[model samples]
Target: MPVTDVTTDPEQLTMTLTAEFEASVDRLWQVFSDPRQLERFWGPPTWPATFTSFDARPGGHAEYHMTGPKGERSSGRWEFLSIEAPRRFEVIDSFMGDDGAPLEGFPSMRMTFEFEADGSRARLRNTTYFDSAEALEQVVAMGAVEGSTTAMNQLDRVLTGLREYAQGKGTRVEELSDTLVRITRLIDGPRDLVWQAHNDPELMRQWMLGPDGWTMTACEPSQTVGDSYRYAWAPLEGTEGESFGFEGEVLVVDPPRRVVTTERMAGTDGPSTINDSVFEEEDGATLVILHIEYPDRETRDMILATGMAEGMEASYARLETVLAE
Candidate 1:
């Protein structure tokens, strides 16, 4: 019945998550490090938060304030533990009452964020360590699972935005629920250039989103259908993201022509329906089509509403530049 980590140690209730973005580690860090960038997606869309003093440095303090239904308010603070400059961080978090007083019975916890990269992707991990078993249980009971879910939801938007921004431009957009989002763009470059950027870590750093302070752990093609590759990304963004191990299965690989693979993240197994990346030739350029799908109506509509279409369009523009270079 756990939320984040749906698989092993469900009873443990401890969580870790990792995800690869279509942008670079530095771009992702900018979003996480800058408070202004989070203003649009820092909390639930319906019930967002207004943060204060998000100083992200060693020994710096951070705080968030929120007011849910019926005038309910929640505030918290964290004491900066250590910083590795855009890569890793440790901090303690605890809920506080409106009067700036820590909740009497709640347990304080320490959390860490770590990031790594793989080819055109980045792996990130966010791990939380509680002082004791009872402490962990108490926080879980208090709804850290769903709370983190909302946080990650906002996180997804931010990371996705940074990806678009890094590519130099982005637009707020969505696709029709029934209409498959077949995104195609022409990049005026050699086929090998596009393929290399997609397959090489050094080249990937120029155009993909990854964990903050990320490093490439592994990169290789899948040998057979259903054959999987593993890459360890720590300080998971959430339990589901962590389970995917920042790795996925290669369903189909045709080299520079086309590559089909499954993406893993903190989720419930068997990879979501998201699939497809194809490259074709057009007039003096390479036409790339990226088609990603969601399983159901509700999720598709939700994703569409998030304005990812515009973001993708912008990202593709940047990809063109990377490929051209």
Candidate 2:
């Protein structure tokens, strides 16, 4: 419930709303990029939005409908004009038909969102332009001002919950040596549950995807020493036959305590790495320590350069949701 400033200027033919969040810019960007996350805070308290389709790139289109408490529905669409990744985007927002087509004679608003980074916090400025002063007043009369303010107010709660989960899994990476990196976290779950979530393919798919738009096509984990596990990922929007493979052999398997494995990134032709994972519990919270050893320093550095920390943190945040479920 911070400052949610909403201003409507008929002279400028625009309605602008500015708000700040306690999360990082990247985290705030995810809420806009990921449709699943966007649905959580895109509507007022009495009316929750459900996105039927969403694509967060330039030239993409989004269709969603918000249902009222009395079963009334309001459908909308967004035609993205430009995108600057985690910083800003412009879209044409309008009322839509059930077939996902723009309705004729309807007043459309051009919305621009700018996300500014302020250290760990972020500031979001949104401006919605109308064709004329009358056009703006027409929508404002339909409750656009109140609905937007309410939706923006819900963002803090959604972002706070995500941050709390990420904090619980205190995931951090330490470069122990040239060829080795240590990743440690205190996961808010029991040891047995954590171990099962890691070894179970169905559970692994729920959280293993990083920030990419890829989906885990396959997860075959053999929970025994000398057995092999194969995990495959392909872009959710990619063409057929394009995929990345990761295969590993279980060297040691001690359930709820330790596991040793060797992993090779098949598509990248990257050097294989040996991973040793240990789990310890205190006060019903499991502490997970993972050591990844590469063949050489260059190999380890190369992987780290690909923003592995951010990707792993995103994955772990999803893992937190899984554990809570």
- Who wins the TM-score comparison? 2
The alpha-carbon lDDT assigned to residue 237 of candidate 1 equals 43
Task: Specify the highest-lDDT model's number.
Answer: 2
Candidate 2 weakest lDDT stretch, 10 residues: 161-170
Number of clashing pairs per prediction, in order: 24, 0
What CA root-mean-square deviation does each model show from the true structure?
A: 19.6, 20.4
- Model 2, residue 141: distance off in Å is 0.7
Q: Candidate 2: RMSD over Cα atoms?
A: 20.4
User: Residue 190's C-alpha lDDT in candidate 2?
Assistant: 83
The runs of at least 3 residues in candidate 2 whose Cα sits more than 4 Å from the true structure, single-residue gaps closed, are 162-325
TM-score per prediction, in order, is 0.46, 0.51
**Candidate 1 local lDDT, 1-325, one digit each (tens):** 1123411124554555444565566766676677655543454322345568887778888888654422346777877888885677788887888778887887777887776666765555777776666777776677665566545544543555333322322332334235334455556666677776676766654444343333334445353557765443333344233212346776655567556566554334744544466554433455555655656776657666755565445545666777666
